[model samples]
Target: MTAAILLQLVLNGLAMGIIYSLPALGISLIWNASGLFNFAQGDLLTLGGYVMLSLFGKAGLPYIPSFIMTVAVMGIIGYALSQAYFYPMLEHRVNPQIILIGTVAFSVFIRNLVLVIWGTTPQTYKNPFGSSVLQIGELYLMPHVIWIVAIVAVLLITLQYFLRGTMVGTAMRAVAQRPTASYLMGIRNDRMIALTFMLSTAIAAVSGVLISPIIPLTPSMGGIIAVKAMAAVLIGGLGSFSGALLGGVAVGIAETLFAAFVSSTYRDIFIFGVLVLFLLFRPGGIFRASVSEKV
Candidate 1:
């Protein structure tokens, strides 16, 4: 490939990587805190995007207010879901496997409900910035792509700081490490788990809104992206923030390069194949830590 083409591909990959990282981070946070694999995450993201589109595009609201409104609504929805379903399941001592199945069912219900409400037709959110491309040397970039990358960077840095610097964030980390001990220490375990879900879903919703300018909104879009994001989480490592970032970039680049050089038809299959290999060989994930069990 020519240098220009390669540069463009890298930029495209980076933009896509930023978009994918949101969901990967969401998955990691929820899994580490609650030990529940939330299958409904992607659908929640889709719901957020549609909610934004409906407010801004259809109802003629300004972009900034619409964005804020969407995030708030989705966060509340996530919190409600945790309180309604997962909280009761935890209280009843439900198996983790069953919880996973319940999440999957929730995902299906949300997706179908969206289909019923919005119909099977696809919709697009009007880009606040008109379709404009910027060229730097040999690389061509879009305004939306820059916005996505910047947003991802800001969020990642802010979240990392919050988790490391704040009391609540420290408490969350403690809960993830040992829930029973955390509760013994007077941390409200349920509230922390619910907060994790709310924060993660809000992040996912923001991602959907940012990427809506680039991709069309459909009820089923969440399913495919969620799978890719899960693969990213595994490839990066389960609980590592840096792992999620690296994994997302790797997947995005791999997909783009493969589609450019090989066949687009096999792009997804190839990515998933890589994920399986990672799981089979390095089950601890790309970034592994050794923990000693106390007697």
Candidate 2:
């Protein structure tokens, strides 16, 4: 590949990877906080996109307001799911596998529900920023790509600050690292976990809205993105935010270069091939998660 095309592919992949990292980070958050993998996280993305489509596309709301509404709506849905289903089971010490199955069922329910309401045709919104390109030196970038990178950078910085600087963020981190201890310390574990659900889905909603501009809106799209994001999470190390970020960028760059150099149709095959190698050789990913159990 020529240097210029290679640079373009890298930039494109970086943006794509950053988007995938949003949901991957969510998965890691919930996993650390509750150890329950919400398979429906991706469907929440689909739900977010459709919600924004209705608000911004059809209802003529301002883009910023529509985006906020989409994230808030998704957060409420996630909080509801946790309070109504996941938390009760957690209180009773339900089987993790069964809880996992619950997530899968929820995933299927969402996909079908979206299908019934929005139908099968792919949809998209008008570009709020219009079609424009920005060139820096020899590299060219789209406005949306620049927006994605900037947003993700801001998000990561804010998250780092929130988790490290604020009491509530500290409590959430405590719960993630040590539920029993955090509960003993008057952390109100239920609320923390519920808040985690809200945060997770909110992040997913952001992913949905950011990606919607890049791709068509479809119920099935979330599943594909979910799989790829999950791969990102796994490759990045389960609970490390930096790991999730790195893993996603790695996957994105690898897949994009593979598509350009090898085969566009088999990009997924190449991605998974890389995943299998990681799974076999580096199962703990770039960073290993630490878990402590108190009896």
What TM-score, over all chains together, does every model reach?
A: 0.95, 0.96
Residue lDDT tens for model 1, 95-190: 888999998998899899889888788899678866888888777778887778887888888999888999999999899889899999999988
* Per-residue lDDT over 1-295 for candidate 2, one digit per residue giving the tens place of the 0 to 100 score: 5688788999899988987888898988888888877788888888988999999999999999898999899999989888999899998998888999999999999999999998999999898866778888787778888888988798889988988899999999999888899999999998899999999899889988988767999989989989999899888888778888898898888888888888999999777887788888887788975433210
Which residue runs does candidate 2 get wrong by more than 4 Å? 290-295
Q: Each prediction's Cα lDDT score?
A: 0.84, 0.87
- How good is model 2 by TM-score? 0.96
Shift of residue 53 alpha carbon in model 2, Å? 0.7
